[model samples]
Target chain A: MSAAARRGVLPGFGLSTGFTVLYLCLVVLVPLSAVALRSSSLGWQEAWKVVASPRALASYRLSFGASLLAAAANVVFGGLVAWVLARYRFPGRAFVDALVDLPFALPTAVSGIALTAVYGPTGFIGRHLEAAGVRVAFSPLGVTLALTFIGLPFVIRTLQPVLEDLDPEVEEAAAVLGASRWETFRHVLLPALVPAATTGFALAFARGLGEYGSIVFISGNMPMRTEIAPLLVMTRLEQFDYAGAAALATVLLLASFVLLLTINRLQAWTRTRAGAA
Target chain B: MSIVVREVEKAFDATPVLRGVSLEIPDGELVALLGPSGCGKTTLLRIIAGLESADAGEVRHDGEDVSARSARERNVGVVFQHYALFRHMTVEENVAFALRVRRRPRAQVAARVAELLRLVQLEGLKGRYPQQLSGGQRQRVALARALATEPRILLLDEPFGALDARVRQELRRWLRRLHDELHVTSVFVTHDQEEAFEVADRVVLMNAGRVEQVGTPAQVFEEPASAFVMRFLGAVNAFKGWVEGDRAFVSGLDLELVAPASAAHRARAHVFVRPHELDVHRAPVPGSFAANVDRVLPLGAAVRIELSAPGFGGMVEAELDVRRSEALALAPGDAVHLSPRRVRVFPSREDELDSLTASGL
Candidate 1:
């Protein structure tokens, strides 16, 4: 046996490694590079003008801001849902557990239509909200609602297994050590849960940042307010400004990449702290 | 603190787990709840810890009724079988948890944690997490954490059940020394009889959701209270016979043994003895029966001789010291005389008074 043959534990390492790299390039890198290549055709100043336009800036704020708000909301309520599903039993528990995956299964357009019917003015919930002077559809809040709807399953699914695997004996130990229920939860349970919860938060936030279909109907695509970056890119495409659309797409992709990378670093730091503790 | 449990009965769903169990633990005494699996020993321990509520019972600590008190308010520290250390907390933090939760002064909490860490001899590893520690080290950390609050009573649920034999033995001795220094009223549950005998001042033997016997280790071993306790304490030989007047006649062999007056009233009785109490002789002797040696097993310090008599229904076993076995030079198929040194006679189950009287035979 030569040294090269024994380099990896598995046989055919070279062939498998080549195939993985080729498949990744063909499927992911090539398409992403095309967007960059198209944007680069325009001069740097022209590309900056397109991406830094006031309209584009407002879209960026709404997109990132609403996604952050929705992900935050999911981290709170989605965590509660996961906890209940993992630790308790009640009537309709199985049904509710299955319903958590609805956003993953439902078509985004159909969910958009349904959410609009329920929260739009004169609709089931919107009529009551309208009487109180609160509007949901055709607003930034509506965009957040749509994002929240799509991002819930990510948080819940990521957190469910971690919560279930937490030993109940630890809680009992805390209690028997003279800690109150709230104290036990704060000092014992929450620290163990933080890393997994942060991972779930990052996943939901990344998913919400790029969301488009459900927000189209609920957000009404109002420029300078409800228009999201994905919708802005579509608007540029519709006007036959392919370079401008690619420029905006490249900017959104880079911003998301940076944000996701930061989140990954944060997650890694938390995991190391937890492990070192 | 002394603890008293009065008729602590509990049932899970439709299955009864503890059936009217009662116990008393004096202050600073170490007691062991010994039983086989599914025998309600752990359940009883949990009930006393206030982790589980009894269907009908009262628990009192230091003469105050604590039946309705929550586990958090009971001021009892529990060390779980698996230690249950907070995986995300360092050892110092874990030990400081109780004091911190109670809103004690920072310096006081730190001093107490340091004191406990030193007491458990884990002072240097205070910054390490639970996963970084070995099983025995984790157990010591757990002990420190449990003692941090200065609890009135301590409960351990099979503390060394998860460790290997070597670590288990070392920790058992360490626990005994720690218990003496702390002098806190403590109770622990274990199914291993040897562990219970080795560590506990008194052992509470339980079976079928009830306590079969409660006594010091020496008392329980030398004088078992019931047939279950006798068999549970290593009684391996049984002889069935009918008692008449002052003697019990063996059914298969031509032998007769003295019987108590109470045993003479029973139509059928079982004589139980430990293997070491049965003596083997090379020739048939008075009050001894002839048997053929079926097998010889060599244990580390003792030799187990399996013997069988002609027309006997079951095999008989006798244990002899290795030196004595070597002196005798016994082998399989050799004829020998077997005599019992001591035996306990109890009425057989099938010959209960109701069955015997109802059949009118």
Candidate 2:
């Protein structure tokens, strides 16, 4: 009805958004555009050559592939953890709930050392796995393990509120209508959880895609296999090949931006269609 | 199908909710469990539907014990106070839920869904989800979904409790007609006396987790079983009184009576007078107490007059015909005389009057 639909959200119009835009430009836009501008010096063909080399493609495989696998794994276990913390009461539940966010608070380098010591071949759980001939530390699997650790809190934080808000009466109604347990879950509970679960999955996946520090100790920086895109970026920066590193960083930046925009659209769509919490 | 509940007892954290309650519901009759809030009416309905289990006792469907069965196995359709329709599903999908879960033929599910939507007069809105509909419409959808499998018994827990007054009145009539058409053995829980009396074939009055009285609407309304029933059914003016040696003396109103031998002695007593039971006369008649008119309020066809005798405990309320109000021509501060046509005397433990007022239900 009015041109300024967002006018009532806060008192000021020009002052609020103008200040916000200036802060965002200084904090994010200027640095990100500097990378894009620097990357243009190599020209498109030379940049493609650097990005499409066999070793570069292999790192991309480990980066995108392991991140996807880690996110898929987090969704299942994180959903269960959220359900338990939200719906049940047990001894030490509060402690367990607070522990879910430990990865977010701890320094990344500290966690990297701690994770390597725990999952190394000579470590406790690692020795048992070594007997089963499964190597986790210093492998792509280890990279995935690190991503899963960092990405878990996003999934749990997103799904927990949605689970808490679910109406138990819906399940009761389904049961009284002659639905078995599996039928009730499939038809009622799963459909209700889908939108929230998708949002959680996207958030965790995007987080996993950009993870660094901890992955270096676990992945061992193998040039053709376990090496990830961020490590390769570090490798070029250490060698002072600034333009080459900027091009790869720009690729990662665009991917993260596209994911963030998709998540935004998804949230707006869900709020309209399913009344998502 | 008929339902029989025998000595059912339920408790939450050792606090008794339903205490050894028993009931009998005849086949194909719509019965209402009516009481104030927290009176265990809904708990009894849940136990009957097999949604909740009793701590001790049994529920029977058609004389067969179903106490051990789950709600899904009992075939009793339940509608909650809030319509529990799946928000993600369309109206047609919600109505067809039970049939599809049972793996019925696809064509049969579609046909039954259509028929139910038609019965509820919501065929046009079948494609819309539950969130898009109005409150009355959503409740109608819930009703249609509950009736999808043609359940042998229907249990509704305050089905229209959340609706506004006008919508509640319309739904009450529609439910009565639908029950008449289907003739399924039905039980509904309600705190509203009017809704129960209008829609139910029989009414079961419960209080403090026990069945106080059960009878047809006219029987219970015309003849209440106890002091609680009388107070719960209508507006009453309770006066402090005492009973001694087969005689009861009521304070304030200057009245006394030799009641039954059961009330020969009591710690405290009460004399209850319903609003309609009081007779307000313009002239001072013999055997009537003198009172002063405090206020006059017109209630549609009837006019209510509030009067206060010089020594009365509280103001007395009397309902009179509109014509009689015009005849008496009473106003505030006007002198009047009033007497009760009927009164009930109940012996109680000491301080019962204060407790009754405190427990304003």
Candidate 3:
């Protein structure tokens, strides 16, 4: 089979590919191409000067660092939540599951305000933490906290179905065959949940990277220290520096695309492994 | 090793699954827990394996009470009907799973797994995954895996129930031979009476969460303890009769037979006789009741003649070999004489026994 036809495992190959390209052009490619055109109009030397300034680098650091931290936190906590929901039966399970998706339904602006009120220096539980000299709101840490809050649901929701589909009999069979609970989970459960967890991680990371509304409210928008890539893009747009904004947007878009590709590869690899076995 | 289950009772919610179930499975003996579906046979096997906890009972293996022990600690092997083979592993890895989990020495694990694969006659297929193997091959792999740990007792829950007719029959003989060679105390749960009769050294027939009869295959077939057992064993031609003095008088037909023992106490009774045991001759034989053949079904090797005798309200199934059927020259609507050799007398209280037999529990 030809290379193009070989990737035709998905149904209605030509039609789906055409639709996917059209959708990408409408939603992503056209806007991204416009951004690149604007950036190029500044000429290579001028674009580099705007993108590599110390403040731009600092914003890059804060944005990438906070996103990584938030994504890492989601991986651990989301796995725990998925395990509990999948492996055990408890009262209010449906309600707990519904609560996990609350972030998806709630407006980001509303979530940002809620987080600030709950964790700000003079707010409810924040007063005690503030008394201890541990600040949460209007800081880099607050940005991370807000990102974590928005990114958590992606991981848990992605993994819950996979975890539920895992056969309990496999674990029992492992145990009877002499493996302890830890061994069973390590050998039988973890291998199956890994691909799902990786997909969740990538999704959360991508979401955290481009996050604007929630982090902007919590970070206090201090340039060089608190401002992120998305904020910088917004700043450039406000100052009518469309070329600089496009350059920054291009970087975020490329990183997100790479991460999504990796996630797709991981999902395919996992399915093949599961099917072969 | 011998397994002793004492007064075992299990209940799910408010319904009892197994009640007052007790049995002794001697070492190296293949005991079959045979009953129809919902008969609690599988529950009894699970209880012995410590997979299901008995509400009130003690499970002892080799003189040690294993009631408090988990399934792993009980050292029992179970092969489910679905095989439940680990699809993620190859045949060798699946067989070696038990050893690997116990953290046995690497050399020993490899050697033992190799040996087990050879025993199951899948040496060439060791590297193949379960999905790559046939249905029969997967089951053999499951059996090899179960036996990997050198279990004290092996439990099989309808292992061949999922196989095709030809494979099921072939596996039964192979399993009997394997049990003899291994000499391990094994208990298998099966709803198929023929399977139990063919494979088990002793068959334990269960009905309604209770042991209806426990005996050798011939014993159970010849002397079923209850009316339920007689019917469940095979198709029986039943004759409702009343006992007077030493004889049982047929209700509708002018027929009488001397009661054997304890038959006089029951005012009304039903006699059980196997279909093949009824002699059908072309001529009106002596001391035989005349019956009109309603239909004749030619099953490949055997012919079944449905007869409506005067005494029995419903038709009775009478089996005859093709040759015997040819000699009789029986056809639909033909008049013939059916003389049953021996019949079992069951009390009228056994009328509800049909429901019990049908439910198999």
Q: Which 10-residue window in model 1 chain A sums to the lowest lDDT?
A: A2-11
Better of 1 and 2 by lDDT: 1
* Candidate 3 chain A weakest lDDT stretch, 10 residues: A268-277
Write candidate 2's Cα lDDT for B16-61 as tens digits. 7798899999899999999888778999999998888999999999
Comparison by TM-score, 1 against 3, better one: 1
Model 1 has an lDDT value of 0.87
Q: Write the per-residue lDDT of candidate 1 for residues B263-311, one digit (tens) a residue.
A: 5464676667688988889987777777899999999899999988764
Per-residue lDDT of model 3, residues A1-277, tens digit only? 7647756675577777789999999997898888777788888888888888888889888888898899889989989998898878999999998899998888888899999998988889778889999888988899999989999999998899988887666776676677778887777788778778888888888899988888877788899888898999999999998888888777777766786797788778776665442
For model 1 the local lDDT of residue A4 reads: 76
What is model 3's interface RMSD?
1.8
Kindly report which residue pairs in candidate 1 clash with one another: none
TM-scores for every predicted model:
0.94, 0.94, 0.91
The residue-by-residue lDDT of candidate 1 on A1-277, one tens digit each, is 8747675666787788789999999999999999999999999999999999999999999999999999999999999999999999999999999999999999999999999999999789988998999999999999999999999999999999999999999999988888877888888888878888888888899988888889999999989989999999999999999999999999999999999889888888878777743
User: Candidate 2's residue-wise lDDT over A129-160, tens digit each?
Assistant: 88899999999999999999988998899889
Return the top candidate by DockQ: 1
The alpha-carbon RMSD values of the candidates against the true structure, listed in the order shown, are: 4.1, 2.6, 3.1
DockQ of each: 0.72, 0.70, 0.47
Model 3 agreement with the true structure over B70-107: per-residue lDDT tens digits: 88777788887787777667788889888888889999
